[model samples]
Target: MDGKRALYYAAIGIAVLIGVSIVVSVVSALLSLAWAIVSGIVSLAVLAGVVYVLYKTGAWLLGGDDADYSASDSVGGSRSASASTDAAAESRQDRLRRQYVEGQISEAEFERRIASELETEEPDDVDRKVADIEQELERER
Candidate 1:
């Protein structure tokens, strides 16, 4: 087995051994009870320390919670996926057209904005045009 799986098994074995030792002391003999309790406590403490050290040192690893794993896994391909982006652009254009048709924005203003967006004649003016578009969208709302 891998080191990680071995560590997990070792941890469980330590826990079970501690429990069995305690039980044997209580039932089989009272003279060993004190020793058993002390040994059990010490064993468990050492097991915990070993587990923690293995975890921190990258020797042992466990999977995260299912919900978190599922969430992040679902989003794993999102950065490279363009499925929703085209729909968003179409929706934005539709909203702009609707606003113009509803008399919220003038035809001349809409044409001017479209020209400014599509022509790309001035790289320096892109930011200003984007700001203007945002202001117009805000006003439409």
Candidate 2:
């Protein structure tokens, strides 16, 4: 009878130990998951901070005006404001040519408009235009 009682206690002890081990494993897993979540959030916060700092620094270095720089200017060198004006003039000329070719304007009207366009050019641009005309004439010859 005493031996049976000892066996019963031993079985209970083993069961208790197994239960404790399972509980410990579950708790450890939960803690690990919590730690991973916290770590991920912290990492994202740090990344965002880094990006913001970089953005502020870049803005400061670029005179704090975002509009002053363009993506094309970054890829190539910076262009003067006059260069944009010249581009606008070129676009206008292209539109005029298209209009003339499409019969929206007569030949005499086209010539008059083109002469007016050339007359409105900046003084500095005139030399360039003359050079371009000379080059075209040479190419024709």
Candidate 3:
């Protein structure tokens, strides 16, 4: 009986030691991961700053396209770019609406995603595109 009791206490102590080691290992790993993520972000930010500075310097040296960069003023070029971009965005929204209607996505998620998509573009253009989609939906119904 005395030997059995000693063995049981030893087993419990071993288990406690193992548990503490595991916990310590997990904490260290998490800290390392966090440090790595922060370091990576700082590095990327510094690289981006360097690239931007170099681009600005090069642009200045080349007499920056302020004079002949009027490509956006072209009749078809800018209009086509705008129209295609709007169409792609409208299609994405339409797919999201369909997913919501089909119960594949929650209304809240749909609203959040759509709002994020619209936020990237001009408010008036987004509004007009949304109105056009609404009209098309009404016609379908």
The superposed Cα distance between candidate 1 and the true structure at residue 78, in angstroms, equals 28
lDDT of 1 by residue, 1-141 (tens): 699999999999999999999998777787577779999999999999999776755522232222212112121222212323344343444456567868888877876766654463345444444555556556656
Model 2 scores a TM of 0.45
- Give TM-scores for every candidate, taking all chains together and pairing residue i with residue i: 0.23, 0.45, 0.43
Q: What's the residue-level lDDT of 19 in candidate 2?
A: 100
lDDT of 3 by residue, 1-141 (tens): 999999999999999999999999999999999999999999999999999888877765553533222233211123235645565574677578778667798767876888788888887767765565455445545
Which residue pairs clash in candidate 3? none
Candidate 1 runs further than 4 Å off: 1-85, 119-141
Which scores better on TM-score, 2 or 3? 2
Q: How do the residues 1-141 of candidate 2 rate in per-residue lDDT, one tens digit apiece?
A: 999999999999999999999999999999999999999999999999999889977885664534344332322334445645666565565566557667798766766776677787886665555454444335534
Report residue 10 deviation for candidate 1 (angstroms). 74
Worst 10 residues of 1 by lDDT: 66-75
Identify the leading candidate in terms of TM-score: 2
**lDDT of every model, 2 decimals:** 0.57, 0.66, 0.68
lDDT comparison, 1 vs 2, better candidate: 2
